[model samples]
Target: MFHRSVLVQKVLEFLLTADDGVYVDATIGDGGHTLAILNAAPKATVIGIDSDKSALETTKERLKFFGKRLELVHGDFENLDDIVLGQLGYGSVDGVLFDLGLRSVMVEDRFRGFSFKKPGPLDMRFNTDETLTAYDVVNRYSPEDLERILREYGDVRGARKIVEKIVDARKKTPITTTEQLAEIVVAGLPQRVHTDVLARVFQAIRIEVNREFEKLERGLYAALEILRPGGRLVVISYHSGEDRIVKHFMATESRDCICPPGLPVCRCGHKRQIKILTKKVVRPSQEEIKQNPRARSARLRAAEKL
Candidate 1:
């Protein structure tokens, strides 16, 4: 069971605007944060959206007691605007919470291939219907493209070596499983490299397979558009890449002018749309981290619409 909700107390404290308002859990996962919101604000209603059907099913069963107050939707958050407008129309939502950590249910499931510790098929698609999988990327992508993904997404130091090994191995036989890929990555690196090298390699492939970065960018903008003035947007991201995107988006939107530094005039016409609530990024407390180690990497930023 995906039972842990990281920073639950802080999320409720910062995210809820009123006792009764519409809230959207953009990545509801197993409804941990959604359930927290409902518990905090008894009169509030939540629109929970997730790409994985299995996640939605788990969330539904876990939160069934909430009754009609929770509306579970099966879709990617990238289409947040369409989902919100189609279901509830525009500009009325009070808060949107994005808990960006992948749930333990997904990681622990050997079939998902998210963890190198588990032996599984190289299928990391959040939505299983997606055509691209880790298997396809490892076997079909050109050496140049493979190196790029490893370097950009994983921040792997020896990306070229990893790609070279992958290309060489694939020539002999298709690298179809997580274990096989991990072995190749381990063999490519020098003996001094940390074991985490394998994990980084796998993570890069998973990110590309799911298009997480693109979806996150779209979802953040859409969340901003749907929030009414004074409404809140709270995001909790689990990695540096994701935290950087959320941080930059909030900083850019909260600034009045985004024109070139040397420009004498403001030609961009960009207006400050939201006010950043947390001057510094918030992290889970030591106690919280001790309880849930997964929360250690979480960086939370919040802003209110102007």
Candidate 2:
């Protein structure tokens, strides 16, 4: 079974104040938050979007009790304007919830290659329709390209060594499975830091397979555009790379003049779009983290459109 959502109560409490509001659960993984949102406000309508078709079906099954109150769409949240706004005929949305990172079900599915602990196909595409996978990346990318991805996406310090080892191993025999690729990464790292290093390498490959960063870049802008003037944008990010972009957008979008600090007059009329609610990111409580270890790294930041 998939793990319970990380911050259900906190998210629900925020949306409760707005009655009969329209909400969007961008990464509606299995509809955990979608159910909560519906439960909180009976009049609220939720548009749940997920790129994984299987997960969307599973979500539909789980939320069948809600009937017409919930709408499930088999599409990426990145295309919010077309899939959500245009189709729904809404000028702006009331609340937006983005649960970033792989869901529990995705990680558990060995065929998805999201977890290194299991031996499965090296396919890490969240959409499943994507042509590239961890298998394609490992076997096709140049050593330099591999090193760059590991260092940038994975934040792996031994990226060069890991890339060299991956290239050498693939030349001898194709790295086809999660176990095989993970073993190669483990072997390349120092004996003491093998597990940590292996995880970083795997994460790097998964990020590349999904074009995760690019999606985030486009998605955040579209999300803001689709939100109403007083609407809220809630984002829960697991990694620093993802959090950096969210934090930057929240700050930049909320500013009146994005000009350099040394500017004498405010010439760039970049109006403040959103009001950042959390001065610092809100993390799960100690008790919550103790119950769900995965919640330990999750950080939540919210903003309201101006």
Candidate 3:
């Protein structure tokens, strides 16, 4: 069920204020927000970048009507600097948006192994070039390693039991498919627990396979660097971990001091770089969430460069 971006109106209202300057949709997943921005600023040029070639291709076809207004680039959000300065030949941008996390298409594609509801390949990589897959982690990771991923990434309550079951199952035969692994984890859990926990486990594997957190850290900072003074940076994250990174980055970027709280003097000389536009993270309205359950977890945060 592909749905429009959670905060389309809000994002467009903020970005469209800039009449003709360049705008970037960092995670241009399915071009949901991209379309909104393009419609809002018809004369403004947009650089839509996505790590998934398939996504860029689909977006290209979906947005074919936009013609020359949209410039679709195939690359990871982490390569924002290279794409912006090296390829586009721009030192600064007017606005940038990141609707982070897995897209609805990714979740819906059982072949991607992002959702536990259906069985598919244990491949969670966004880009096909990546060697690591969910299969590699599930079958090869040590028990402690599996436990760490489950505990840290999944936040699963029965991480120990689940990891033990995984290690035990892999010994008999390599866990080659999503069903094989999901069955192992499901069997390890109590019947009373909902399948949502299992979903988190899958999410953990996907995140590990793609190094999502690291990419987000690098990508957000890159956006900060590429943005022109007074340029707006809008980010929409779907999970707690992703949200925490955005929260911290926005807070610190808008802060003046990095010293300890007790220290009165400014020793670090950290100057504020951004002015936060949304103090409280904006969430999808109830109507939107009802229309698209996936949007339930979405949170939007915006800031302007100093």
C-alpha TM-score for every candidate: 0.97, 0.96, 0.96
Superposition-based RMSD of candidate 1 using all C-alpha atoms, in angstroms: 1.3
What number of clashing residue pairs does each candidate have, in the order they appear?
Answer: 0, 0, 0
Q: Per-residue alpha-carbon lDDT of model 2 for 143-172, expressed as tens digits?
A: 888889999999999688778888889889
**lDDT (Cα, 0-100) at 270 in candidate 2:** 93
Any idea what lDDT model 3 has? Answer: 0.86
lDDT (Cα atoms) of all candidates against the true structure? 0.89, 0.86, 0.86
**How far does residue 274 in candidate 1 sit from its true spot (Å)?**
0.4
Writing each residue's lDDT as its tens digit, candidate 1 over 182-220 gives: 888898357677477987888889889989888898999
- Which lDDT value does model 1 have at 67? 98
Query: Among these predicted structures, which one has the highest lDDT?
Result: 1
Tens digits of lDDT, candidate 3, 1-306:
344677788788666557787899998878888887887776888899988888888889899998988899989888898899899888899998998876777878888887778778889899888899999999888888888888887788878988888888899999988887878888845676758777789888888998888999999899988999989999888889999999999989899997889987889999999999998888888988897787888888999998
Candidate No. with top TM-score: 1
**Which is better, 1 or 2, measured by TM-score?**
1
Q: After superposition, how far is residue 230 of candidate 3 from its true place, in Å?
A: 1.1
